[model samples]
Target: MSDFLSKFNGENYQEWVDEKDQKKEPKNPPQKETATTEKEVVETPKKEQAEPKNEAAKATKKDVAKKTADASQTTKSKQEQKPAVPDTAPKKNASVHPTNRAQVKQEQKTATPVTATKRASTEETEIDPTYQKKKKRKRILIGAGTALLCIILYVIYYNSVHVAMPDFTDKPVTDVTKWATKNKIELDLKQEFSTETDENVVISQEVAKNKKVKKGKTVSFTVSKGADPEEILKLPDFSKMDKGSVEKWIDENKANGMKVVLEFNDEIAKNKVIKFEIKDPNIVAAEYKRKDYATVYVSKGKEVFEKDISVPDFNGKTKAEVETWAKTNDIKMTYEEADSNEVEVDKIISQSIAANEKVAKHDEMSVTVSLGKAIVVPNFANFTPDEAASVPNLTVRVRKQFHGSVPFGGLIAQTIEPGARLTGKDETEVIVTYSEGAPFLKDYKGQVVGDLPRLFYEDYHSKGADINYTLAYVDSYETKGTVVSMSNFNEYVGMSYLVTISISKGNLDQPAGYSPKGKESLGDLEEE
Candidate 1:
């Protein structure tokens, strides 16, 4: 009996132990319960199994809790051990569960990539301010260089092949352009017509020589064309044809486009055509076209006929016979009386258009018939200045000059002698006496007494009149003082005597003085 009790107790104890072990196994509750129930259902075993399983589940939960607590402690300890961070820094060491921590770690790694990317981007954005400015300056330099190049090219092109044009005068437009081109100068042409000059000539221009101009620049010029040739056709020729023949010729020439005009000329022969002309008298003989009719002028041909006849020796011919002969020979005769008494009345002395010379048949001739001479008048003497001026066509002038010995207002010597024949045509000269002012008469008294007569005579000779005077005498003599003189004086000294002189007189109006011989003597004196 004792042994049986012992075995039963041992088995109960083993079962309890086994149940506890089973519960401790790392398995789910259902699986554990199913496994435990399948083994035995003893009352004591069942109760133990249920209790142990419940305890085992609780232990497992406790173990999980402990592990979480240990991890949190480790995180906290690490956070405490790490250096303190500023409030602005993110908390990287904050405690978290395994799965949550894994997510946070992954986020930090992703953020790191983003930060690195941003840093790289900032580094790439950094650029030098001066570098940007340099780039702009380079662009400006390029533009300026391009502009400079263009300007230089323009200057070079302007210098090469530049030309100045030539001056042209009176050159035609049609020909001037050609001339300019031939001379390697650019040409600009202007045209004009002138009545004063021939046609087709240049009149003006620009771009004178030695002046610079761009290549291909034109020089302007003016040109002229002469007056219209048609205007030359209107003129006419009316030479040497008689009135009737001229009319006939005009009619005939009109059919051939020639014009004719007629004008009377007294010097030309009557009823005859003109033979000489100014506008190319030989134009008709030149055989030019009728259109150039202005090239001709007409004039009457000069009369060349000549005739000669006897002069009738009119030296002794009577006036009636000479007049009859002159009429028959178409001669004009005229007569004038001679001052000489030699020639007889009604006799001819001279002829004009000298006899025996060939002359036109109707030409007029003149002759002078002679008549008996007549006595000529004698010359007048002692004419005064007023009397000398009375002659027809005679001029007189009076002048006074200083004479040492002559009295003021006194008559001087005559320029010509008295008692000469006076004539119609003669020129005379006169001289007049003069004296210093009456207050200066003392100068005349200084002269020697003997020279006083000569001095007075010389003063009288200077008077511009036909008169003679003799020195009277000195009335009172005072040294360095004038002497009183009379108009008519006699030989006397100290006391003056008045003397009267006779002068031949006849026609006192005649020129100052005349020669006694005649008109011939007066002429000889004038010659001398």
Candidate 2:
């Protein structure tokens, strides 16, 4: 009886009941219990040590009785639902009463898990295979959904850290750098010579604009260093180069000490470089640098220096002609002006050297040029006609007119003003007015006949006196061309007063066949 109680308390009460029902092969399958009895059986050890053996036995019997009743009810219900298995028959000892050794023995025999496993397998076989396939498909779908959720989360994370690339071409490098710093982007900046882009500006980008770029990723771009400086930095041969080109090179290279010196070169053309000199003697012209103290000699043709030249005679030549000659001969010549009646105006009066003299080139010489004759007029107010007529270098013309307050043959006025200068270009003839005494005929007795033409005739005509003169030739003892007598003597002349002058023809024998001797008037003599 103790062994029976031991087995009953040690084994699960519900399991024992299920075992007993299975061996009986009832006509129906039992319903499964909601709660398992394994946990309660495991706690039985602890409860058996706490309770007295008799009490434990009592509790165990009660639990067995309750489980027996539950099994009987489940059998009855299952029998009504389905038919039982036909292969196995019911055993007599397969009863819920645990006091029967044979019943416990039969229950133990049927309690093997293999039989339960086989039964469960038989029941599982009745299920449709497609139901398991559906479960497998559901598992696959669940795995795919989890994987998709992970992918979605990764994409969201990637988008949050990455951004689209901006347009950087032609933008300033500073702006690009600031953008990079703000976006946590790294930049691989490179510089290149560009004619199209300005200095410090981006020329091109390795990444396309608006393309995705992860933060902290390196982006490559080219920056402009501006137009190429190699053109200006190059050093070329300066010999025989144009002056303007050399000067430009010097200015671009900033060769402060380098200068251009123009020198005479007979072989080289003007405005072309002849040679160059650098302070460093070892450094030649081909290897010159901007910092070197260099000098470039340029050609300005040759200097002018004539070895020998002949001195020219400038007499009677114009100053212009002398200047032209001096220029051609490369002779230094100086000029001075003087008034000369003999030399013409603008003509060289004299030269420093005589004609055909030997002299060196570029010698200094002087020339005197003529400004013609300078004639200063004199005041004739206090002078007589005779004195005015005797003035030098001037042709004096005398005219007599009646004056109220002057003596006969006295000077009146001159045509040219006093202190007036007349050059050789002007007319040198001057007319002087002389006073004739009051329109009167002077006595011409015993006066030379030349006096009529020299004085009295002009005096009478100048005063508008109507005085007439008659010349009679008669035998007289007087010099030739002398007036012997006059009919009117010292009278105030009227409108047509006649003055007869008897002039002596030198006393000589008359020649020719037609010789007439008479007191003939000047008119009769003229007619004859």
Candidate 3:
């Protein structure tokens, strides 16, 4: 384009261009030759060039003289026109070129508008590529930044809008449910008993508080119902059974889950001891375990009076009277005899226990008897044990006879006549009577479990011995229940004895057995 313009500036083209410049330059000053001149040049060419074409041949030679002179003269004359761009970053300053703007405008009356238009266009062409690229880059950066800002805002709004689990434990159930409804969440409620938490209050929660969750998510929780009821249970009528025995039964029956409580009851008989009592006496193996337990209520035997009491005077009471009093008051007594002229024989003369001294119920009382001044032969033909034993010079030997009842311990005969002088060395021998009190146990070992109790009384007690019985059953192959063992073997008729009876439950499978004598066969019963 520069080569084209340089070649086009021939003598004729130069003359024509100068002629036009000189004609139009008078209307505007060079200060107006700004970055805006290119636009005016484009619009004015058709209008201004018509006039120049008509006179083209006439002004041909004079253009050289005018163009050279005008250009040099005009440059120095407009020494301070408005700075073209006002600087790269333009600012409005009316004070700028205070003297130069008016002077240039006034002096440039001869410069044509065409020349300024040409120069402005040339300057812009050189700078436009770099400047336009920078403008486009600025636009691209702004567009991308706006889109990124929108994305970040969207992310923040989405996260903030999500639901989070609230602390249910802090609020009541109604408040929590209301909050959940408002936030569009589902609550999974469950109830349980707790000592630390009140009834209807939440005891624990499955989901943690303040965790962000999706809308309508379900949360699980446990609400407390306060404390539950306590349950009571009783042991299998552990009559006369020791604590260790109860413990063993509990372990074997899987009843260890229950708590054991020991209490004292006076009505129950003694075990391996002189004390036992069991009440609410239904005895069957427990079928199931309960979380709570009942009191077994084992008797420590009837409550004893541990406090002290004054001794009763027994100076003249008969043996029968003392015996009756001791049985009524639950007192124990032992009698020792010695000769004395002062107190009467066959009467409590002086108590071995002092009169009016403090005494317990079980403390022994020995009553010393007295013989009259001298021994006279007394009539002892049909005397009782008391009458015969009290004879002053007589030592009595006693024997127990089961039949020919003259009453228990009654004397059948004695050595002396009704009246005689008592001066000889002699001892008196007498026979005493006894009766049947209990049944023989060995005969009842193979009897049916249900029939043993009736047979024990009718067969054993109706004849002699006194027996206390206990019944225990187990699974066996013989029958559902059959008597298998007995505890006593003394075969005596007068003494009180304990008999532990074992029976079979007669199933194909036998329960596990624990016997110190190993397992018992029908005839291999061991005495415990």
Candidate 4:
């Protein structure tokens, strides 16, 4: 059947021609005219079959032969009128047999639908004049839609990647720094002295607020550094200011080399400014800057009567009068007694500070008071040797004696009577004696043996019996001439008894050429 269709199509179907057949064939006719011709050919036989049998028999064989040739001529013209299909349309399996009606019917029933390319070509062949306008409109709409979609996606992506610049004016720099850190941006910070803006606050920004910016972009902003030191600052008139105001000013401006100095001034009152000067002598105090060195001198008031004072004459004045004068003048006075034949007793003889000599208040002064020509001896009874020896204008001599009534070491007697008065030109000597109680031999260990005899004699002698002691030397671990031991110490010995004592040689081993200085009685020892 396919072979029969191929043969039929090769002879009758001009629209399904291959490239080689198309090259040989003439241009085809309109598809509508060809379709009209095919319809007439198909219906002519139908018309003959539908006619009455007598009418069919009346037609002659010649008429039938002429009708068959006309039919052939009509079929060839229809083939010549077939419209050409585009080269892009499918051509395979497109042929059908015309004479085999049953085959044609079966093929038409099983044939694939017409391809869009072929349909389009057929439509184009009969297209109206407005078709190109409609097609151009559709193409323009598609291209515009594609471009709009791309722009929408780009906007979404751009918004996600970029950020808007924030307003930084009048805000703390810390805020700007924090925002920059969060956005992974770099900051180009500049400092400017602003009178209106506070320190560490942003004054201005290079980028305006709400403007788009990419991440990691470097932005420049200016931060305030408080007021301008050189422009806004002015030095105050320190000469007319008090110490407190000047000091406070110095403290506030000390970083700029301002200071205050205190000095003693006789004219200006205490704590008042005497003068002010800039450290650079060429720059006057009135034109000083915050960074200029300035000094304000404050007065410490007059020093009159603060230090120097005239010494008062104390000659021939009573001690009471001199002390009163010293107390009133705040002078330190030390008194001493001197025997004077000219001045009266208890009167000031002389003063260490000469008459009208200059001296400071509270300065020490030595004053000498006169004791009259008659020097009365003080009572030595119950007085120790040291107490007796401390008397002024008198020399004291000490001696020990045994007494039955006086306590041990108490004063016993003095050579001159206690009330005796003597006219002495110089220091008068007085001898006072102390009691040793009852005389007894004493332990002399660790005592110097050289004074033993004198001690015993003084202790025992009282215009009566005199005690004596004998001495012996020995090699011992004690200092030379020091007593190591003594005999008859615990006995009830009285005066005039002979007591034995041992003296150390200061070495355990005796030396060569050493002589035995044998035991000697007190009388012999004293004589030697």
Best by TM-score: 4
Candidate 3 residues lying further than 4 Å off, grouped into runs, are: 1-128, 163-186, 190-286, 289-528
Across residues 1-528, which tens digit of lDDT does each residue of candidate 4 receive? 454344223222222222222343446632432233232221112222212122222333334334444544554453456553223323467653555656544333222111211222212112134534555687799999999999999999997778899898999999999999988879999998766777799999999999988887899999998655564246677678899988777555432466778887869999999997778989864566666776788998875455567777888889999888788888888999877789988888888879988876667888998877777888988467878888877788987766656767788789888877765454479999887776666666667877876776555554234567778898774558877667767554554577788888888764465544433332243365
Clashing pairs in 4: 29-81
Cα lDDT tens digits, model 1, 207-281, are: 565677665566777666544433332223445446666556534433233444445455766655555333455
1-528, model 2: which lDDT tens digit per residue? Answer: 665455445344445434543564556754544332222111111222223233233343345445544544454444345433222423666544545666655444333322343243212112232533555687799999999999999999988999889999889999899999999999999998765677799999999999999999999999998755533234577775889999987765556558999988879888988987777889765555445676799998866565467776678988989999889986888998888888988998888888887666667789998988798888877677778789887888877777656667767678898887887667888888887766777766656776787566575765755667888997844457767668777777654577777878778654456344433443345465
Q: Which stretches of candidate 4 lie over 4 Å from their true place?
A: 1-130, 208-211, 228-232, 235-528
What lDDT score belongs to each candidate, Candidate 1 first?
0.44, 0.67, 0.53, 0.65
Q: TM-score of predicted model 3?
A: 0.24
Winning model by lDDT: 2
Candidate 1 lDDT score at position 347: 68
Assess every candidate by TM-score: 0.21, 0.25, 0.24, 0.27
Q: How much does candidate 2 score in TM-score? A: 0.25
Q: 1-528, model 3: which lDDT tens digit per residue?
A: 443343224333433454455556555544544433223321122222422222222333334335534553454244235424222211356453665665544343324333544443422211122433454587799999999999999888877677777787835677777887898878898887555566678776777888887776787878875554332234455555666787676554444344455545555553212232232235323432333343454446555666376767888877777777767766777776655566665677777777678766665667765443445555454555456666655555433333334454544444545453332222333233333223334546666777876876665555444656788876555556666665664464434567787787776654368332333455653333
- Using lDDT as the measure, name the better of candidate 1 and candidate 2: 2
